[model samples]
Target: MNKVKLKIGEFSQMMQVTVKTLRHYEQMGILKPCEVDQWTGYRYYKLEQMQRLGAIRRLKDIGFSLDEIRELFEEGSHEPNEAQLEEKIKACEEELKVLLKRRENLHQMIDSQRKFKSMEKFSIQSLPEIMVASHREVIKNYQAIGDMCCNVIGPEMQRLGCKCSATGYCFTIEHNKEYKPEDVDIEYCEQVEEMLKDSEIIQFKKMPAVKTALCLKHIGPYDRFYQSYTEMFKYIEEQGYKIVGDLRCVYVDGIWNQDDPEKWLSIIQVPVEK
Candidate 1:
């Protein structure tokens, strides 16, 4: 008998896939032969299998999981409908969003580790209750607030005779939501012995005493402080402590050079409960 159909081996060779792989796809219901010889139990592929084989290859190239591809094909006709194409597009978009978020987090971690290696470790100690002269505003721009801290806030502390305490600086967000960088309330403060008698920009506020925290001493560049925060949180978790209060970042030294992140000294403290 002159054969009109290709056997499994012939199809696999033409498609550049192994016979085992083709059999597995069959088991997965992604690809099934048009007919099987009853006596020999040999699978036969018609010309149509070539189209299915090409589709499977293309879908796999786009990061589709085998299970997902199988589902797609199970519901799909020989020619996919608009709805099916839309489903594939949506799935790929969702996967891209997840991958992008993971990439951002990893990049932040790498930058943080580099900064951590340059820091000197210090012991955690209790901070005394202190009075702070502060300025409160609904900060719409965090970058501007950061600038205000380095320029307006730091000098104000120096003038008030309230040198940077070892406890670090505190920024309390009164109201936060899906806020732009400029729309958050940022309060910048420093401990002072006495309130300024005549000051327009500075006002007095009491900082509530925190009992415990997993504190890490980080000196040099605020850019690396995120790494310090990440480390402190991990340490707190490893020690079986839970964060009980808002995190505090105390600026110890403020150099005027915005270009140099290596010269800034800051302490990051995460309040915790043992």
Candidate 2:
């Protein structure tokens, strides 16, 4: 009877794997050769061992860990169990998704920091309470507010021959917890030279008297608007002031059609007291 066996060098070449990799796999117990000569200390592999080596290489290509590949080989077949493979695939997918979201959040934070660095020096100014014509709507869906602003509010402001003197968008917090993006109650308002009367488009809403904040000026895209708010809050705390009322974002420019970040003028306001 003839025994078909190849030396380690020949087996490595035939299996398209480096000799060092084969030795490492042997140490890992995933790939054991047919026999090893005790006197010569030489490794020999049978031709049938080629199949398992190929399976190990394929699993490695698919990002499988050494331990996972060991488990696969311990099952004693070239094909792994379908359920186990599926579970690994799902785990890898979930990890990828989390990494992608973290990357996006980092990008947003960097953009905000850059914007704050370029802004003019902000100051604290006390603004008197003024009556503002307003309307309230229960927002079940957040998308509806954006639609109302663009489609309804934008057009209605133009129709009433009213230009925004000081416009703001605020959300009333139900509890002390941060408002979820989707569950926020958005209040959009614009200040005019004089309150309109007997007009269908303009409605009278009372704005309570309270000591509030006045920030310098911000001109940019709304995506990074939160930066201004964050800086303002930090300044407020540093000056030993406490927030007394709801926050507001006042618009100095009525034109929202401009795409340039430099042209959009907005002022972020916070109600505060000593």
Candidate 1 structure, TM-score to reference: 0.46
Top lDDT hit: 1
Instruction: Assess candidate 2 and give its TM-score to the true structure.
Output: 0.48
lDDT tens digits, residues 1-274, model 1? 6546899999989889999999999999989999999999999997778888888888787556778788777777444567767887998899899999889767766665576666555345555567787876776565465677777767766676664445554543434545454566766666666656536667776677777756687755554556766777777778888877666666655554434344455677666778
Q: In angstroms, how far off is 209's CA in candidate 1?
A: 2.6
TM-score list, all predictions: 0.46, 0.48
| lDDT of candidates 1 onward, in order | 0.70, 0.67
Question: Model 2: which residue pairs collide?
Answer: none
Worst 10 residues of 1 by lDDT: 254-263
Clashes of 2: 0
Best candidate, TM-score: 2
